[model samples]
Target: MKILFLGQLIGKQSIAFVKEHLASLKAEHQIDCTIAVADAVTGGYGLGKNHAFYLRKLGIDLLLGGEAMLSKRDLVEELAQIHFVLRPANFTGIGNFGYGMRHLHTPKNQQLNIINVMGMMGFHRVHASNPYQLVNKILDNPKHPSPFTLVAFSAIASAEKQTMAHMMAGKCSAIIGYGAKAITLDAQIIDETAYITDVGRISAPFSVAGFTPESEIERYTTQRPRKSEELISDEIELQAVVITLDDETGKATHLQPLRATYPLNVKAPANTSAESTTP
Candidate 1:
C-alpha cells in the first residue's frame, strides 16, 4: 500500500496546486491514501472547518495541522468532531482541540493507525507533555486493537523526530515528519528498523519556502543565514513522501521522495535579485 503525504499549504494557490497534482498522482501512482498539513490552508492561518471538509472531498484522507490550526474558535469546535483530521496529541490544557491521532478505516480493505505529536520545544502556547510518554500510553492501551502504523508532526526541529523514531524502533511502522519551515526531502532509516521523513511545503516554486523573501532576507541577510520558520528553499516544489508498506508486516520498506514544480515566477529584491524567472 502507498501513502502520500504533503507539506504545508499556505494559501489558495498552494491548495489548488496541490489538488491538481493530487488527482493525477492518485491515478498514476495508485495512491492508497493521502494526507496534507492543515495549519495554513485558510489564508496561511488556522484552518477553517469548511476548508478541512473541502480537502477531504478532494481525496485527501486526512488533514493534519499544527499549533496554528487551534487558534481559531469556530474551527476548533468543528475539528473536535471531525474524524478525518488530527491535531497534536501532546498538548495539555483544559479546552484543548482535536485528536492527536486516527485510524484509517480504508474501504480498500486495509487498516492503518496514524498518530500526530508535537515536540516540547516550540513556539506553541499550550502546555505540551512529552510525546514519547503519550506514545507509550497509546501503544500500551489494551482497548486499542490496532497497531501503531505511523506518527506525524509539525514542529521546530528534526532532532526530536529522529530521536523518536529511534526510540520507537520496531514498535511502530514509520514516523512521518515535516517542520513548520524548511523544504527538503530528508529521510533517516534507523538501523533498518524505522523510517522518519519530512515533507516541507507546497508554495510558490520560486519563493523562499513559499513565503515572500522580504522578511527572510531582511532578518538573516546580515551576519549569518540560518534556516528557521522559512523552509530551506528559494524555489517552490510541491514536495511529498511516499512509503510502501509490507503487505503482511505493515512495516514500511520502501521510501520514495516526490516533487513537482510550476512555472510561477518569484521576484527577488534588488540586492539579491536574479535575472532569470525560469524554473
Candidate 2:
C-alpha cells in the first residue's frame, strides 16, 4: 500500500517541493497515500484556501483538480472547505464547490473510490463535461461502497492519446494521468485491468512543462521569430507515482515513478574522502 502520485502543482515552487519532502517521504518511502494536482498551485493559476490549507499541512492527503482549478474565481467559497479537494467531474458550470467522487478510507480498510475527471481537452481551453460520460456516472453513483477505484485525469498534452484514456482504463483501479510533461511517464494497463500513470511535473527541473520556458516562448512569439529564451526557475522538482497497493485487494500491484530533486530539505555534506577531503 503505497500510492504517491503527484503531478501538476506548478507554483510556489511546487509548494516548496511539497513542504520539503514530507518527512523524508514518510520516513523513507513508506508513503500510504499522498496525492496532488491543484492546477498550478497558486500564482500559476489557482489553488487558494491558503494553498489548500498548506497542502493539508504538508502531508497532502488528497487534491486532484484541473482546468487550472478554476483560476481563482475568488477561491470558490474558499475551495469549498476542502473536503479532500476533487473538482473535475467534467466541470460544466461548477455549482457545488468541488468534489466529483469521494470515498477514501484507507489505513488498511482500503475502500478508496476517488474519481475526479476532465478531458474534453482541458487546461486553459477549459470547458469540460463528458470525461467519458462522467466516468460512467461515477461508476453508477458512488458516494459510498467501494473495494477500490481511482481515476484522476486533468487533460492536456493532447489529451493523452484519448481512447478516453483507454476507456477509463477498464473502469478504474488506477489511472492518474494528467498530461505528463518533462518526464515521469511509465505505468500502463488499459483493457486488461486499469492502471495508467503520468506523474511528472510538480514544477521546475529546469522549467518547460511547468512553465517559464519563457512562458512557452511568450506564447509562440512572432515579429521576426529567430530569437527565443526561457528557463526561469527556483530549481524544484518532485515528480511522483509510487503505487504498490494490494494490501488485500486494493490491487495496484506496482507503479514506481518517483523523482525528487532540489536540496530535498538539506543535510548532505557527509561524504568526503577524496584523499581525506582533498587536504
Candidate 3:
C-alpha cells in the first residue's frame, strides 16, 4: 500500500493545502515516500517565512533551491527534517544530511515514491532546466533505488505532458498529474500510459488563485428647504486588476480583475429642489 504524492507550488496557499492534505493521503493510501521538485520557494509559489515555519511544525520535509537551501543549511537542519536540494538533483546528494533526508517514511523497502514538480508558467528562472532532463537524469543515474513507483505533479498542459507520458509510459509503474493542469493532463496520460490519472495527490479547492473582498458604505444627511423629503442611494462598481505570472513559465499568463460595488450615498449636496413639500 505504498504511494507517492506529486504537485506544483502555486503560492504559499499551495503548500498550505498540500500540508493539510498529506496526512489524509498517508492514512488513506499508506504512502511511504515523497519527492517534490520545485523552483525557488521564495521566488515562485514558495513557502513564505510564516508558511515555511508552519510547514516545519507540521513535520513535512521541504527541499528548497540551491541558493535558499544551501546557504541556510544550519538553520534548516535545526528547524525541521526538510531538505533543500540544490539545482540539478542527482542520486549522489539524495541522502545528504544537510540538503536531503533519509530513512524517512520508513519501514524500508517501501514501494511508493512521490515527486512534485512546480509548473506555474514563468515562475522559475533556472537556466536549461527541463522536466524531461530532470526525469531522464534521475533515470540514468544509478544512485536512486529502483522497483519503486514514481508520480509527477506536472503542471504542464495535457498536450505538453503527452511526450513525457510516452517516454515514461512503461518505464515507471504509474504517473499522476496534479493541480489545475490535471483537468486535461490526466486524460492524456491515460491515453498514453494506459493508466487512469490518480486524483489522490491533489488538494481540493483546487482553483489557482485566492482573494478576499471588502465593502464600504458612505452615508449622508441633507435638508431640502424645510420640505418633506426622501433619501436616495446609488451603488458604483470599482474594479481592481492584479496581474500575476505563471509559476513555471514566468510570463503574465493570469490577469485577475476584481469587481466590487460600493454605494456613494450622496444627499444632493444639501441643495436639491424639493420634490414634495407640506410647509
Task: Specify the highest-lDDT model's number.
Answer: 1
Tens-digit lDDT string for candidate 2 (240-265): 77666566655566766777676534
Runs in model 3 lying further than 4 Å from the true structure: 4-25, 34-44, 59-105, 111-126, 149-155, 178-208, 212-279
lDDT of each: 0.67, 0.64, 0.35
Which ranges of candidate 2 are over 4 A from the true structure?
Answer: 1-5, 9-31, 35-107, 114-116, 122-129, 141-144, 147-151, 155-201, 205-215, 223-234, 237-279
All-Cα superposition RMSD per candidate? 7.1, 17.6, 18.4
Residues 1-279, model 1: lDDT tens digits: 778877787655565665566788777777888888877756455577667777788789998876665755566876668888788887777364678888886556787788888787765466677888888777777244654277786667778777787788777777777765454556655543346446777777666655567655765676454332333233347777777777677766777777777533333211111111101
Q: Which stretches of candidate 1 lie above 4 Å from their native place?
A: 94-96, 191-194, 215-236, 263-279
Number of the top TM-score candidate? 1
Cα lDDT for residue 4, candidate 2: 74
Q: How close is candidate 1 to the true structure, as a TM-score?
A: 0.82
Prediction 3 TM-score vs. true: 0.46
Order the candidates by TM-score, highest first — what do you get?
Answer: 1, 3, 2
Candidate 3 lDDT score relative to the true structure: 0.35
lDDT of 3 at 21: 52
